[model samples]
Target: MQECSPPAQVAGRTPEKALLSPSRARYGEGMSRIDRPALGILLICAGVTAISVNDFQIKLLSGGYPLHQIVFIRSAIGLALTLVLLRFEGGFAALRTATPGLHLLRGLFVVAANMTFYAAVAVLPLAQATALFFVAPLFITLLSIPFLGERVGPVRLFAVVAGFAGVLLMQVPEAEGAGTVSPGVLLLPVAAAFLYASMQVLTRKLGAQASAAALAIYIQTTFLIVSALFFLVAGDGRFAEHTTNDSLRFLLRAWHWPTPEDWPLFLGIGAVAGVIGYCLSAAYRLANASIIAPFEYLGLPLAILWGWLVFGEWPSVLTWAGSALIVGAGLVVFFREGARPRPNRAARR
Candidate 1:
């Protein structure tokens, strides 16, 4: 999961204000801990590593199964894991909220983002797909201004422009002899990035109204519902044909019974989702966004490693250059945010 809003400002107050406000008191316990930047970094790193593994497994399974079936199985297992954690945290009551509409909307975005991302990865090299998705933070910064009422300084705006430029560079076709990836294919991940960013913005908006675990459960529930619907509607015999193109095949393929050998990988993806989702939400909860945000770039390198070692795919030189710009621009925005002083409570209101 991407970093939603800044933890402190999620509920429209500082930690001190959160503690004093009765409605915000329950939320404060999750947010008021002493900042531990190192722990935040470790947690984020672990979270991303788990997500990468899940991606790798999805890619491996894409050949044999439809994307929706894979998602259904993975999400079903993940939901079970989430419910167990929710039970320990506060059970059903922890999930109660006045923002049910926002949760449903956020869940819709999650479904769109995950489905598009998986579609992209099914066709593109893992490194390339991951790099494209890294644009989410840029999208978040752009979205935050209107959605969260944050002011964007000129520096952050420049970073955003530079990051889009990087995206363009990555998509540009190589010289005559070099391999050419379809522009349409590249756009899927970009779309996913936007939806993911939108979902994060909503998450930030709801952060004060809900616990991290509750927010996570809602997302998992959305996944379960969407995936199940897709599986049921598209699982018919008419769509069973396998095609030469992996991406289309992944999207249009029909559901099939999972083999004994496939059960573990499917179940493992669910466990990974539970762990990654919690760690990500918790990491943002534990530290300032700027302090923990940069660590997300760690996913790019990990994607490269997996693409190379597992899939025998390496990003081209152009991909690396473009990735560098995107990563650099995101870090610049985060650092700038950190340098600004926190707004006064009255100012935030």
Candidate 2:
């Protein structure tokens, strides 16, 4: 799934290549012809909505199906959709790349991150899991220091520290009720976010070396392989028994044949994933990352809405407080980065 932010720009490129080359350019000529900021905002909103719906469907299926089985089916369908789109763009030629190792490493991170997040959402409230996932931007900031050689000033450093504090607050028990959350469960999404941030860092590293389509194909292929292995190992006799732990059961549950009535829902997930992935890439292409990145927080409210409508869950007081700090800290990093000066055209070459 496309996450909250676009990868940072690739380092060291000529001005002409940056503006004219399809792989190097932020958006193609068609997208550049429009009002970029406005179009970007709209696309980001649509992308966020599509992904939220996808998560809702995944959460619904998680109750009855094994996590790996669901990923296999969803990703297999999604890969078919991606291939159809790829044919229009340039067939298999568009997927050609020299950085196969980097792509595979990035794909591994994607698989780990998606599996962890799926496990988290299977047991936790959607809003709560999503809120914790927002800390990814903070993780990205820290990872960039070493992986991308980006410098962090004091203000952004403070944001990182405060953002983590928000994570801690989220785990605290409320005054009126006994905490229903298992402490171990909270770690799932946190680890997912860190892995996701690491994946984004790798995305930045490979942004110039590969097209977005190519990167996506690599990740989906990894998903297919990993999920299939899980299915082969656990889908047969293993599912004959049941586990009491919701998270463990979600992870290890055996694949059963989907009922005839439920086929459309499973297929629809692939379609949703396709749209979400496209819009996110398109959004970044159309406008500056700073302009569109903050809108990603829209996921939180959408999660709350779906949680209430579908599962009758609401955010607790601590959830609200924690979300505020997390969102505020993310905005701080975005704006600070936006305000920094960029190298001149001549310097870029």
Candidate 3:
């Protein structure tokens, strides 16, 4: 731990890592020969697409299944897949870390983020949930100042302001539509964004002591344990019978065996979880986030596409305008951070 100094900014892993995708620590042994940044960009694009699909499937099943049930199933499959990946990610040694407490904290943060975001997704349109979730980056920018001791320039501050303004814009739901945005519904993903941003700061503090897969194993295991506990207590739907809140019902509903038709979707979600872990670990490690981070916004449009094609969802014009500002503000921050020069270590001494 003494050998690795803390990152001055929210560093380690990429934007995709905090996008509610599972976190996998990286060991960069395989991608040495290729152009790292190019590959990183490609991986990010692919990763964001996978996240969109995973969320879509979750949204589809939320009406019929409890949040914990779906997560429990997905994690069971995902953990097995990640165990297979662990062998390549330095195996048991990767899991050996002096900072086990930090790992535990990171895993909890991710679980908190996932639960809040998807709870919103179950009731809100996919585009709107995702749009609010993208605020994680803005959170990272703001959190970095306090957690990482980084200074925010005027440009980054403005970006953060504009991003929050966009979030406020997204708060007013269009028309009196069912399942559209509402006063409190918008806060679910926003809360998730805050938790995810906190997780990113912890990732920075971890300082590469943990590998991607190892960190993911922690999160996946945490998710499994937490979801299972939820099942033990709430799997019978007893608590949900009286609840009128759709989001609360989604969380409190009983678990059920996936129907034959739903099996493939569950299995696919697990498989995509694995793919997202790899793509993200390889991406942020291989390229400068400034170069690849903006592309993470691909999730927004992809979410829109998935919502429309699968669920017939179309975001309102207000949603559209808000999405643009959030994405644009994040882009400004990413480019500015990339262009800013790294301070010399020798000069500090």
Candidate 4:
């Protein structure tokens, strides 16, 4: 073999063409990543769908079981799921933290938020409950005053006023035989709204310092524990003994447990709801909470459609008008937020 030398020409390619190959040229031009803002919006939408499906399942099971029982089961499942994710991320040692008290407090709020929302579903139409819950964003805005020391601007204040008005319109008291609205049933969502809003504010205040997966695990675990205690004391703890429809009947007071034939429906609920939760978590991380919070109202229409299709319940004219107002105001806030100028670092300095 003779001493080798660099090839003068290979195939029909020039020296420059050989050096500037397709892969090398492409490497200099970086790959485009997913848009963070778009990702955030998608994640928020996913979260809404997940919670909606979860509510649907609760609605189905509510007739046959106490709301707390369903909450307990869901929370337990969520906790297990979260723990599994946390383990995959970094094992149990990753959970060791100095903010145990804060974690516990946040967990309490999560339990309250979930339980209240679930209870609302048991008493109100899914649409109405969802609409009322959308008020949490306004609450978060107000909370910024005390918690974050942020000043509430006139525009945001007006938005808050409009939001409360929309809530009032959706939940006005019914006059004698008028049957216009069930203010009492609506109260459930209102109470839920307050707690849910508190939860949102607290979550923001905590930020991404704590492991989100771990925080989720703690919240779900707390909910399970609290729900179990509540049910045990409420004297509805015998659901596990419900081997027959008759036993289930006594547990629910007026409804019956689903027969074996209906197991598919429950399983469907679990699968759909599980997917929703996972998607929402991913979305929540990608978008601005304030911006994405409003589209949650979209769930009102979707829930109403679901209610009509599944349970044959139609919303009243007032309900429609109120929902429109709430959604419209929410849109206003979202656009207004986007229009506002982001702060410049030079000004702060």
Compute the lDDT of residue 4 as modeled in candidate 3: 9
Per-candidate TM equals 0.88, 0.87, 0.87, 0.74
155-270: candidate 2 lDDT, tens digit per residue? 99999999898888888777111176578788787888888888777766545343445555777788889988887888763753666767778888878998887787799887
Q: Cα RMSD (Å) per model?
A: 3.8, 3.9, 6.3, 15.5
Off by over 4 Å in 4: 1-35, 173-182, 237-277, 338-349
The lDDT, on a scale of 0 to 1, for candidate 1 is 0.72
Q: Once model 3 is optimally superposed onto the true structure by TM-score, how far is the C-alpha of residue 4 displaced, in angstroms?
A: 22
Candidate lDDT scores, in order, read: 0.72, 0.72, 0.72, 0.53
> Model 2 scores what on Cα lDDT?
0.72
Write down the worst ten-residue block by lDDT for model 4: 1-10
Cα lDDT for residue 141, model 2? Answer: 88
What tens-digit string does per-residue lDDT give for candidate 1 at 283-328?
A: 7666666677777777888888999999999888888888888888
Worst 10 residues of 2 by lDDT: 5-14
Candidate with better lDDT, 1 vs 4: 1
Count of clashing residue pairs in every prediction: 0, 0, 5, 4
Candidate 3 lowest-lDDT run of ten? 1-10
Give the Cα-based TM-score of candidate 4 against the true structure.
0.74
lDDT of 1 at 286: 61
